[model samples]
Target: MKIRILRVFAAVLLLSFALPSVAQNVRYEQQGTAYVTAEDQWIADRLVDQAIGAPQGADAQVVFYRTHDQVPGPVRVDGGAGPLALLESGTCVALRLVPGSHAFVIDGRTVTVRVEPGERDYVRITSAPTGPKVAISNALTFLRLVTGKRDPLYASN
Candidate 1:
């Protein structure tokens, strides 16, 4: 009985450590007017540096993914340019933003994102009952999208 109890305790202890590590892998933060994860920050920095002689302008790269399968239709981004569509679930697209403050209407929600020269910003769009929602993607979701991995965002459906 003691041996069985020890084994059960060991299993629980192992899981206690494992679960938090998994949770820690994804984190979110609000940077300026945009929401971003630590991974997004790194990716944006790299992309910005790679742009050869890219003009010093407030630039933004937006990623839109479906969080709920029940959402009706695709989410749309309008303003600061043309209307960009996010078709299908788990689909992601990048948008280029010009410097200064720009108002973008996602679905039916209007969110104002500010971009500063020489800096790259990120935003994420998700589904909501009222309409589409905009926020920053967590590290795990962003990494899965960028790495072409099977994302849980669509797998739950």
Candidate 2:
């Protein structure tokens, strides 16, 4: 019994030290504007950087996709969650999205796509002149963009 107890203690000690590295998991999900305040954007950006291996104070990958409808029309698509990989807030989680099609609505169209971990993906905004742009904001600006209502980055003086 004493030997078994000692082995369990050693295993606990090993896990205690191993947990921090395991905490590095990334949770990726599309943040709903309704549920997220502007400040959350900063947090989201930070999480994205960490997901792509940038971690805090480092740069990461961010990409955007635009699409024009085969025929002229409003760009519309429904995009929120999918089977693709995503890193999200609340929990530092790393997992593949649910295995299936997810709808993304933007502009005025609809798109069905799959999402997974590390699969940086986006809804194709067809028939739109421009799609959402993804840019890296330094820590300060990133915070301001989230906390401030007006986009200081694009405000006209």
- Cα lDDT of model 1 by residue, 89-117, tens digit: 56665555566777877767787766666
RMSD of 2: 18.1
Best by TM-score: 1
TM-score of each: 0.49, 0.23
For model 1, where is the 10-residue window of minimal lDDT? 25-34
lDDT tens digits by residue: candidate 2, 25-50: 22112433433444454455555556
Q: How many pairs in model 1 have backbone atoms within 3 A of each other, for residues 3 or more apart or on separate chains, i.e. clashes?
A: 0
- 114: Cα error in model 2, Å: 0.7
For model 2, what is the alpha-carbon lDDT of residue 75?
27
Worst 10 residues of 2 by lDDT: 86-95
Q: What is the C-alpha lDDT of each candidate?
A: 0.58, 0.39
